[model samples]
Target: MAAAIERLLSEISESEDPLEELRSLRTAVSETPLSGLRESFSAPQLRVIFSLLNTNDKEQVEVCVDVLERVLQVLDPTHLVQNCKSELQSGLNHPDDSVKVLALSQIGRVVSHAEGTIEVLNNPEILQDVIQSIGAERISVSKEAIATLLKLSNTKAGLDGLFHSDLLKDLKDVMAISDVIRYRVYELVVELSLVSPVCLEYCANSRFISQLLEELTGDDVLIRATAIEMVTNLAQSQHGRQYLAQQGIMDKISNMIIAADSDSFSSFYLPGLVKFFGNLAIMDSPQQVCESYPAFLNTVFNMALNPDPSLTPVALDTLGLLGGTVEGKQVLHKTGDQFKSVLKRMSQLARDGATDLRVRSLEAITQLLVLPVEQQTDDLLLLTESWFASLSSQPMEMIKHISTQPFPELHCCALRIYTAIACQEWAQRLMMSTPGFTEWVVDRSVGKGKEAKDCKFELVGALLSSPSTREIFGAQNYLKLKTYLQEGPYYVSAVSSVTTEGAD
Candidate 1:
């Protein structure tokens, strides 16, 4: 094994195809036991592998990094920091972004240990190198550098090293590079803030959150769009939400939505703004958000009617998210005629719009209509039933026709819609009243693919699980439906004994 390692190293230095040599070394190092690797691999030999990162070939650099990660796993962490530290630091300072990424990755691996974290954090030059790499021209290098910094932040010593020193100042300098890089740093800040309230406090103190919030109302619509997304991410946590609310960021966003109606370039940032409020609604109380910001619901309904392809889907998705909760459903239901118009539009889009629009519209309808057994109140049920009725004169037949389409995604989505409503008494009555609908439910071959089959099984399970099934379908049909559920989604009879099959 030692001789083989020597031969591969020699080939890597001499061979015209060093990538092949690197690949061979990667496989060798991965398969060999740690003991065998330690006996054969020396520190100088690993440095030689590290030198491969200087190469122009991206694939070769990747293979070299891969081999080093495996070999480094077996080596003592102290030895790596003591011996290989300079080599990795050079890689980080290397002019080539690929080399920098390779180095950042190795440092990331090292910093996963307590001692390695302390060592890297103590070295100002190496630490600065990693932070500056966040602004690298190549996104891959920037991403790796950000990942390394995130790993460092995971450890107490490393976290203090970052937040206690000129870390924020360095990050602020990096943000001056470009809007693209700025958002990358913002992403890191948002991620770190989510770690704990203490980490969030560090982020807030750094003024990074303030800078991010300012970007929302900034002149650049694209930046405003980008900024809102990060702000939305920060709002995901309880403390973060409290912080943003304290700043009146929600109300400010509400004002932006109202102002968007007159802005010609609103399309650029409008979707993100709607999504922020949508997520905010779902995260907090839907009733509270909608009641607090009537413009949010109003804009969503308007965007749904808008012909701009980009805006409509966002609006549909936001609607779906808002309707996922009981409060959200009630909020929409209370919109009355305004909500009815939106439902009418959604029904049309579900049948005749683009594939994505159709799917999203169906999903929104399902979220609005489906009620969990626990949350099923008389008022909510009536609201869902009314929404379903308002969808079309024959909502069931339209969805059934959609299920017949060849696309498996549409088929599965349609089945999910049925499953969502299968337990409702009004839905059950409609199924019984509709021609061949009950037979369609029990038909094993009605849908194709594993997902569609699973969805069909769920629908049957929902029906059988419902209290009204025995009374609604009668004992005979109820037994047949129950047997279908028991047989499972993928069940098939060995003998083909179909009395009749429904039309595709």
Candidate 2:
């Protein structure tokens, strides 16, 4: 295949009108395996092919780019772009809009290959050409220009050029004037945000957030939801939220959540809206946010208890998001009985062939069971036991599936519940008789589990919290349990003395 492609390239190079030969080459190249293409073309030969893209014929330009796009799978970008720059710049100015747009898209691919190359984006002439094309009357030129600018934004040199030039302001103007351009602009902003959080600060300070937030209030739910995501990213910094709050944007987001909630919230944007406010609620502070804790808690609970299993996961996630705060923790504790009921019902659903529900059941259990001791009680333990019973009744293969899932938090919850039950001597003895009970207890105590490690403090606290656990473990398992509970200054000194020669 390499021989054939090479022979065809030689034939095409010798032809008076290589366009016809190049057209044939495309078919042959496509059929020829990619490895063959790479093997057939040396760097010099590939450079020659890229150089042909400068032709006046649009067909020749397209075929050249198409072939390079394929060859790029193996060709190095430094060599590819060095030879193709003039050709691409010429193609970008082609009379045919399709040719121009395709050239721009291909440029993105090429620049992506040479990702860290500053020289590609640093060329003053190329930057000016792209900026001029951005203001072109033709939509294709405009789109290509936006794409190229986005690609340019990939390099620091490109970003430096954009900062020095009027590109940012121009892109903003185009975004304001054209709906087609606005989506691309917002998307570019989001993409840039990953590389630089400061990029979001620019978006927030610019009219972009205001424009996006205005769309959130619009009738189009899709736009509203997208705007919500855009705002959410921007709100990641405290300054971003303060900017929103100053502009009364938080009130708008809160209102949108309430308004969106009045209906089913089954739209694509609903999740983003829910997440945005959920983030805002936690980030801004619980007591200060105009919304009351009970109202927010009830709303989340309703969503958790919804018939749709999908809502349960996000609701559980929201609870986890809020779970980090003191107020949120206190609220979950205050509503312990309600959470227990939900857990009981979810466990029943887990038994009734709703595998997805069971997955989310573990998630909710992770959040609830990891709550403070004021949140834990005998009722919660009963709910946990019922879920375990359901899980244990499953076939061995199904049990393996449950074991593989990533739920370190769920494991911690299990340990804490184990500690709770272990505090009761009768229950501890009963659990000891259960299948694989000893291994499970040891695993929870000092095993290779995240929650296992986290439960260390809780283990000591639980043992010391209950007179029975202290007396029982103190009598029989004191040394072992003390070894497990060895943390903090006192334990550090004790362990250090044991290790020191002649110190004891």
Candidate 3:
């Protein structure tokens, strides 16, 4: 393999065309790890290959950058970067935008661990070069440049260094040039915000905030959504939210979305608009939240009925949160037609043939029950009939199926709902009539600990925890069931306790 790699390196060095040489090297590296190939090349030969990154021919430079990216795999990236700094600087200065982006791309890879990489950490200009690339004329160049900056910002040195530079102005310069670059840069800004309080403060620049607010109502759908999301990320911090509210962004959005004329602006983007305010309302004072979202619930309700599967889940989540608030509950009660329709929609979704969607719909219904009246009223019959009525008029078979669900949360949640209904007098008779309910509780509850896949202990625990349902199980085997429950985790909680991170 050493001799074969040496032969390939010799062929690469002698090739008349650098692109052709890179092509041969790419194939060799793919078949043999670059580690294996690096040992065969003498130091001088490696420099010759690395020097191709400085080639003024843009296409060959791209190919060569691709080669350097692979070489860094087996070679010491920090060492190679320092050794080839002059060439990389030349690549950065190349007039062709592609070479500049590719150079920044490589720099991004090299400075990835800024704590240890003296070439970038010790040098301020290397970080400046990355920031300057953000203002490149071409979008691709700036996009890669932003990605480069994102990688740098993740490092401790990068964090300490980026917050100190005139990064805000350079990022604003990119945002001013193109909406495409604007959002991409904002994503990097959000990352930088996570690292430092000063960076988050810079992101609150008045001019930048004004532009983001203006873009919130822009003619373009993509631009509007981008603006909303940037605001969302910033809202993650309390100071960030205070800055946003000081700008009156929350009120501006509330007025704009509530305006009858704003439908054209928001119809396609209702999900984003709903989410923007939903997030805002959650973060603000309860009195302010109560006064702010009176008109938006109908739009969210409509989203529940919209056939777009992806939108439906987020919309349902928003609705569930809305229903939890004091004002949102009143809104649901005031608009019973809309409220029941949503319940009916959730019920239908719970019964859908798709298991995953069924799980989501069931969970959403559980969130709705946070509003006590909704649960005590129509939602009660609707959910029970949707999840349980299919197997029997009761929950015995329904609870059994739930206990065996692949996801433990589903078992925990569905049974919690089933438990609510089971405490009712009629539900007791339903449990008494079902044979599978007894078998699952007694066999799994008191039987040996647990098995490979199936678990029903959470369900068993739920049943025994309740006085009404416990009576239905009869008192003869009470002590045995009690002893089994006392043992470590029942199957359901036991399975839930297992963390699968890094498992085979």
Each prediction's TM-score versus the true structure: 0.91, 0.56, 0.61
Model 2: per-residue Cα lDDT over 1-504, one tens digit each: 666678778877777678877877788888877767666787666656766765688778788767866776665556655666676676667665655665566566665644524556555555555655665568667767767767766665566556545656666665665564676667666555444545555555565656777887777676777777888876777766766678887666656556656666445566676677678777777545524424445656776777766566667677666654556555555565776555456555433435555555555444433434454556555543443443344422233344444555444444554554455444444544556643443344243444446565565555555555545444545545555565521232333434667875
Score candidate 2 by lDDT.
0.59
Which structure is stronger by TM-score: 2 or 3? 3
- State the number of backbone clashes in model 2: 0
> If candidate 1 were superposed on the true structure by all CA atoms, what would the RMSD be?
4.3
lDDT of 3 by residue, 1-504 (tens): 566657767877787675776776666666776567667555566677766665567777666666656665565567657676766666677777766875787787787765334567677666666766776777787778778777776655565556545654555665676666677666776655655566566545425555666787787876777787787777777777776778887777667656633455455566676787677666664335645555566566777787767568767777667655655555555665666777667666655525666667666655544323334445444543343344334435544565456655556556555544443434556666766555555564433324411234454454566565556657764555566567635434445557698987
What TM value does model 2 have?
Answer: 0.56
For model 1, residues 1-504, the per-residue Cα lDDT tens digits are: 667777898888777668887888888777778878876777887888887777678788778778876787777766787788889888888776666876788788778888888888778678888999988888899899889988888877887888788875787888898888899999999998988888888888888889899989999888888998999899899888898989999889999999998999999998888888888888889999899999999999998988888899998998888888888888888888998998899999999999989999999888888887778888888988998888889889988999999988889888888888888888889999999999998998888889889888888888887898899998989989989988888998897655656745
Candidate with top lDDT is: 1
> What is the Å distance of residue 497 in model 2 from its true position?
54
lDDT of 2 at 343: 48
What pairs collide in candidate 3?
none
